[model samples]
Target: MPRTSTAVIARAKGAPVELATIVVPDPGPGEAVVRVQACGVCHTDLHYREGGIGEDFPYLLGHEAAGVVEEVGPGVTDVAVDDYVVLNWRAVCGQCRACRRGRPWYCFATHNATQRMALADGDPQAGTELSPALGIGAFTEFTLVAAGQCTKVDPAAKPEVAGLLGCGVMAGLGAAINTGGVTRGDSVAVIGCGGVGAAAIAGARLAGANRIIAVDLDDRKLATAQELGATHTVNGRDQDVVAAVQALTDGHGADVVIDAVGRPETWQQAFYARDLAGIVVLVGVPTPEMRIPDIPLLDVFGRGGALKSSWYGDCLPSRDFPLLIDLYLQGRLPLEAFVTETIGIGDVEAAFAKMHGGDVLRSVVTL
Candidate 1:
């Protein structure tokens, strides 16, 4: 039998989300039902609300979440009932080409629960079919997801803080450690000091990068970036970012420049603010209309390094989430600082406003 639960839903584009009764199906084969303990408000969730992601209206919002496994479907053995886990959107299919090549992080076919949950009553609802945001909608009291989407972690950590490892935090950290290949003694520059960018700074520090530079238009966020272990901060509004980065790196430019802002302007800045043969990582989510303008082909040739776009920070959820949680437990990674506030499910709409105003790093919803 389907369980009735309350969830925040994006009923239509440009409209505020509504808390409604949503039906959550029982775990099907290879699936599990998670009783959400905490979920973070991410920009991607906002994008889904604004219809920037898809026409899938009435989307069951929220993805970065930590919860206890309430039940598991057939063939599920990695996790059991009552196990504490961080819900991940990318459930890798071991048989995909990327997985076969030993790069499951780039798995083309990620998995989600096979069954669909509809409105409990017979009446059809308005707006599109309630699409699960990133395949792991955790805003509800209980959510159905592929068993592989659940990555078991330490229960001792606060769910509000641990849940973040599911998305933005993981993305930023992996961009630096996995995609940018930041190493000891390397100079790293991260453009955009939001949660994702800040996480990149922490990841750089964790990876032993000697110098970490954080760039942002907001001073408050830049200050937060500093607290998270950024050695240098650049106000993008007031300075020539490329020049400032070069100055900080002994005039050659940073070894790696990550564009966490996702705009063409920042992408160009990241492109120019790196040392010769240095990597450029674009981790920000870009609007559909944005495109790269005319640029000399020779510049690309002259750059002489990889220009890569990191998807979920090139993260292999199964491998990274648990290790990150352990690091958090060991006090090596400051995951607690990411949580600005914890609110109830009803506060998500207001939280979105705070997010838009750049007032907080993250407003987590505790179920």
Candidate 2:
């Protein structure tokens, strides 16, 4: 039977999100229905509202989430009913080229529910289909997703904290550990110091990087970065970013520099803030209008190291989520620090306002 759920939706581009009654259908083959426990407010949700991601109106927002399996469709064995799980966007299809090559994380064809959640009867847009954000619309009391999207995690972890690993936090951590390849004695510099950048700092620390330098325009964010494992903080508003980063690294620059801002300016800073043969990882998302910086072609050839863009932090949820949760449970990772505040589903709009003012790392919606 189809059930009605109160959910957040973006009716049109740039329109404020509002609560609406949506119809969630029963899970079909390869699908599952999750009773969401907690979901985090992410900038991507804002992008969806602003039509930055697409012109898809009536989008079901919220992707970073955790929940229990309420129901599973036939042919599903990855998870069982009542199991606590973290929702992931990438439900790797084993037949994709990336998956066949033992790199499922880069899967070319991820999975989502075959059925669409619709506007409930009596609404003006009743029966209209909704495009789930990142294929995991989780802002509702219950959401339908592909069974593979649900990765079981320790039940002891707080939903607010564990849910973060579903997106931004995972992206940042993977950018450092997986993409940047930070290791013992390596010097790392992370530019941006927002939620993602701060997570990268924590990743660097966990990976045993010798010195972690955090760069940000906002002092408060930089301070937060320090608490998340940044050994030094650079206020980019007052200093030359490259010079400050190099100065902290004894003029050699960092062995690994991550740009969590995704702007061309920040990318250029990351490019120049690394030592010769050092790695530069771009984890920040750039808007469609943004173009690559025009640096001398000779410079690209001159740099002796790798330049890479990190997608979803290049993470494999099945492997990364459980390990990170274990670390968090053991008190080795400060996952709890990322939760700036918890808000009700109705408060997401206000949380977006706070995010713009740089007042919160993440405002989680507790169901």
Candidate 3:
């Protein structure tokens, strides 16, 4: 029998999300139904609510989630029912061109559950089919997803903390370790001391980066960044970010500068804040209207470094999730610190306000 679940839904653009009764179908071929235990409230959910993502009205919002597999479709051999798992949005299809070229991390085609969950009336009440946010909507008791989307991990870890590996936390950490290639003794600077930025600091520390500079406009966030292993903190509001970063790194600039605040000004700062042959990793999502302004052609050439945009931190969910969870379990990674509060599903709207105010790291929804 199909399960009835309560989910937060954005019925229209610029509107507050409401709790709705969604009907989740049983697992189909290549699909599974997970009983969601905990889901994190992320910025993407706010983006979807504001119609920044698409006109996919009635979007089922919530993605960073950990759950237990209640049922699995035929031919699903890797995971069994009752297995604790972290739900990943990127379920790589091995036959995609990226995967075929031995770069599964850049898998071009990710899979989602084929069947659609809908209102019980069976009519298209919302005028169109509701799109699941990031293909794994978890603001409910149960969610349907591709079998490959479930990454099994140690059940001993708390769901609220472990689930974060499925999204933002993973993105930030991987941005430093995998994308930026922060090496031992390298100087790293991360702009924007949000959850992602703080995670990047932690990742740099784990990767053995000697000098980690964290920049933020808010002093509270900078303090949090410092606690997360940043060797230095720069107040973007009061100081010149690029100059401060250079001053901290023997005036040669940091070896790598990560722009965790996706804006024209921050991107410009990141471009000039790194050393020659260094990397600038842009993990922050930019608005549609935001664009880079005029820059001297000579500056681009003289920089002589890679300016890379990291999508989900170029992370392979299957490979990175478990490793991060293990790191968290062993007390090396401070995943618990990311959770500012545990909220209920109805508190998503309030969580968005806190996120906008930059008052919380993450408000996890515990089901």
lDDT of 2 by residue, 1-367 (tens): 9889999999999988999999999999999999999999998898998899998789999999999999999999989999999999999999988999999989999989999999999899999999999999999999999999999999999999999999999999999999999999999999998889999999999999989999999999999998999999999999999999999999989999999999999999999999999999999999988988998988888988999999899999999999999999999999999999999999888988999899999999999
What TM-score do all the candidates reach, one by one?
0.98, 0.99, 0.97
Best-matching candidate per TM-score: 2
Model 1 bad stretches (over 4 Å):
122-129
**Whole-structure CA lDDT of model 2:** 0.95
Question: Candidate 2 vs candidate 3: which has greater lDDT?
Answer: 2
What is the per-residue lDDT of model 3 for residues 1-367, given as tens digits with 9 covering 90 to 100?
A: 9888888888889998888888898899999999999999999999999999888778999999999999999888888999999999999999989999999999999899999887655445733456899998899999999999999999989999999988899989999999999999999999998988889999999999999999999999989998899989999889999899999988899999999989999999999999998899999999999998577889989989898999898998888988988888899999999999999999999999999999999999999
Q: 93-212 in candidate 1: lDDT tens per residue?
A: 999899999999999999888986555564358222478999988898999999999999889888999999999999999999999999999999999999999999999999999999
Best by lDDT: 2
TM-score of 2: 0.99
- Write down the lDDT of every candidate, Cα atoms only: 0.92, 0.95, 0.91
Q: How many residue pairs clash in each candidate?
A: 0, 0, 0
TM-score of candidate 1 relative to the true fold: 0.98
